[model samples]
Target chain A: MSTSKFVRQGFPLWLLAGLLTACTTTTVDEFRQGETGIESHEAIVILGRRQGSTYETREEFVNCVGERVSRGSGAIRVIPEKEFVDSLFPWFEPRTAPLRTSDLQALMEEQVVADKIEEYGVRYIVWVDGQTETTNRTGSISCAVGPGGGGCFGFGSWEDDSNFDARVWDVSSFANVGTISTDATGQSYVPAVVVPIPLIARVEANACSSLATQLQQFVNGD
Target chain B: MFAVTGNRKTTATRSLRVLAVLGMLALLSACGASSLVVEGSYPTPAVRKIPLSLGLYLDENLRNFLYIEYTETGAEEYRVSSGQTHVQMFSNLLPAMFERVQVLESMDDAAAAGVDAVFAPSIEEFQLALPQKTRLDSYEVWVKYNMRLLGPDGAYIADWVLTSYGKTPMEGLLSVEGGINEATVSALRDLASNFTLSFGAVPEVRDWLASRQNVVSNQ
Candidate 1:
């Protein structure tokens, strides 16, 4: 084979491998207590656990999960976490939110809370707790500009891991119906010559998608 | 040679002017104080109201409170406008906890009519922690208040410090002012929730309620 031809073909193959390396790997684990199903009129609420001292469950991630769960035909109705928490006010604030299934009974005993719960027809309360962390970083890229112009010359790679768990509570039964946990990990690279090219990893997005899918199937009794 | 010297002198003068302008801009930015205002309407609590008409006195000190904290060298100032929002929140909170509340202007007015209890709440301390100081991704606020529960005859039933805390995560590009404001509102919500859930749990308040019950039963 001619040297020029071999170089062109090998370059495409190398780029393909780089792209594949940027992809995320996700795993989901689900545990259901028993047969589970949701009525069409009922709704679900996904809330992020935010009481930790070292870390907070990101609000954007919780909303992403909500959006993912509530898509497509015959999609489940979802009550936004903020709206539901505000409708109940002090009861559902981070400090006062029930930490266990048993606490739900006492919370529902309040007449106004009971009435509001009935009004929303909320069936499941999904409590998601976790954080997405940039695990490891390597290499460095530096750029500068002068009268002649400048560019970056470096190749850097970093890993991100997203691990999260969701606990589903059946509001009517006042019991925890199921739990689903998901984790996604990916490596991203930035290689620069004249300009920097980023092969970004969407580990957080991957975790959200799979968790939402598992939650939907678990709730719909599929 | 003369032309080269003149060019050098001009270049140096222009550079000095640029440096002076940059220094002035820095000073101006430091001197300008930032104001934080908390604004979130409190929701009516769902707890059963205490079955008694109450006299509520929100004093001017609590209504128009502002805290100004200056740096050690006094180069910058941080002001928190919290008093008005405190009034707004307590207005909703007090009504929800009692059967009827009469807004009183002074403690002397508490002696006027058919009121069984009175409450006067005041700020004790306010503290703010920025992310830069804490080396954390959160902006936190702590609010301390003296919750005074008084009898109709100006007797102190209970005087206790009710402290609440709140923190908001400062992700990516959120402004420090917005983060602190969010934390303040969260702390206010927390204070309302703490008061609502713990009112009957406070020892002095519990004793007073029990005494009131005894007197009613004896009657």
Candidate 2:
């Protein structure tokens, strides 16, 4: 091919490569310790663990996972974190929440707590704990407006890493049926010429989907 | 001659408008204050009420507690009015935990009348930290409470000091006032959770309950 023809052909390939690089890499792992299955009248509650000093399991991620797990084939009823926590009130508050399966035995002795749990027909408690962080930022785009006009002219990029872990507790048996861990990482770019165009990666969303899928399969005994 | 007067009047009117706008801007800048009120509501706890009539003394100081802080330059002021939230929290949790509760105007008035016990809850100390000031990722609030328990005869039974800490992650879009209010509400929830689950474990409280049981058994 001629040199001019070759150069023109390479531009599309470069663009394709840039688009692909914006995709996030995700992985989901599961560890099962007991049998898992849900009944027609049973529901699962998903709560985010927020005890970490430096990081918080974002509420948005918890809601996303709950919405995901509540739909599709073999879909089960899922209780929202806020509603479930509020329904239980002080018992499920961060300061008083049970940290171990064994603690539930003591908590259930409260009578009121046990009664409420039974009323909700909750069979599993899923505790999600994780956060998404953006780091390794590079490049910068500067834009200034003048009396005449203004435009951006530079490139900026950053890496996003999302790590999450979910533990499923069988309320009836007071056992941790299994645990799921998910991780997603991606690079985002903003190549500005006149107007800044952001090719952002959906790291947190990808991780949520991966985790929710695994949870559905695990709950259905797949 | 007519044109000159008309031009002068127009200029004077324009100048006055400009001065009025400047004055309003100056007033706004001079009053750089942040006042936070708790917009969140408390959730009722699911607890078996203790089978004892009680009198609760919620004093003015505890009902209208406000924390104020100013920047070193005194150009900006931060205020957290947590009194209403704390009052609502106590009101909700106490009724859930006790069979009968009488709101007392003063400790002396009802402490020795129509109740088996009198309970008084007060804020001892409250502290708040900003992310920029503490180099932390969250805004934090710390509260210390003095829980006073009294017998039917207005005699002091126990004075327990309880401490609670709560923090909310700082977000890029969350304002300082919103963060402060969130942390304060979190701290209030923490206090209620702790007091609810563990109050019976206190030795004095346990003893008082046992004594009441003994008296009831004799009766």
Candidate 3:
């Protein structure tokens, strides 16, 4: 059988192999361990995510950072997305008009940090950017395909991988504080919508914990 | 003929398998899509009432008759001016306050018609205090208002004072019309809501009247 024909015939072995190869191994040791280079800052201001139709999960990452920073000696603050937008450009309402990335970057550089320095007595700022991707694999067994080709034992498996990347910036000296990447995968089998196979939750939790731990290390300097 | 029939059956089976697989993919995608979730929460004041119209005078400069200009800083001046105009178009769109005031007045009128009580007009004054070093361009508005209840005795029954402030940063530009107008409107809405809550919570008038009637009966 021709390879293309084989692929068309629902043989996903090659695709699965490629995805497996693409998965990178990350270890605790691979992550930078200490904050030896970090300076003692008076405050930490968490940046809001970019504006879009959908809500961004960066706020979760921000809360994680805020939790970690509060344990340290620094005063932790979150600039309300509205206040930040108003104080920075005061012109572009993100609610109505989507802010361009370039414009956002410029506002971050010129308005946010400058005003924080002046009004909030902020000496240091922590800026975080986050993005997530997801993939899922499913299998089923059926005696016969139902309406619209629905059935089980027409065994099908799908594999999906999403990448979550976050970067933290230090405002005082305008340096990158740290960066983190995480991946989450999920899989399910048909005939039982109730049972999730339990791995999907574990995968997502592991990704969240890994990101949080990386940020904590940055905050702790350990 | 038999061989051709077998080939046709095999093809049908394979097609069925492909269709089943696609259905499974669709179900899986739907499940995964529904799993991502986000939530938000905001802090709300436990009690939102400020009592009104026991009077306190502000400096004459802070009175409502002053004309002010609004200005913008940096590159944002243009876009924000447009945004301000958009916001200003509906500046008086809060009809709820007027509705509530009308309802309250009607209730008071009914009460007076029954000779149970008399209704008196309440006075509200908003004041703005410019920060020292007048060149600094800081603006803060203070609002005060009072309400009193009078019965057949023509005596003061109850009263209270309400005050709140709104502040804006100092920009060198000399226009307060557009800039302070937005802030002032927002502050006034909040003030009105607070006043309504306080007015709804008045117990002193009813309690004092009850106590005085009891004393007269006992004597």
List clashing residue pairs in candidate 1: none
lDDT of 3 by residue, B135-196 (tens): 54455555565555555345566776665444444444355443354345434434444443
Give the poorly placed runs of model 3, Cα more than 4 Å off.
Answer: A1-41, A48-61, A68-113, A121-127, A140-162, A186-199, B1-219
Per-residue lDDT tens digits for candidate 1, residues A127-160, read 9999999967999998989899989989899999
lDDT of 1 by residue, B68-128 (tens): 7566577556788888889888888988888899989888888896688889999989998
Q: What is the C-alpha RMSD of each candidate to the true structure, in Å?
A: 6.5, 4.8, 23.1
Q: What count of clashes does model 2 give?
A: 0
Candidate 3 residues A80-158, lDDT tens each? 4444433432223223221333433454454433554557544434444444443455555445545666433344444
Off by over 4 Å in 2: A1-21, B1-29, B74-76, B111-113, B172-174
Ranking by DockQ: 2, 1, 3
lDDT string, candidate 2, B69-145, tens digits: 77878654887888888878888888888889887888777745689889889999999999888988789999999
Q: Which candidate is the best by TM-score?
A: 2
Candidate 1's docking class is medium
Among all windows of 10 consecutive residues in model 3 chain A, the one with the lowest summed lDDT is A89-98
Off by over 4 Å in 1: A1-21, B1-29, B72-74, B211-219
Which candidate wins on DockQ? 2
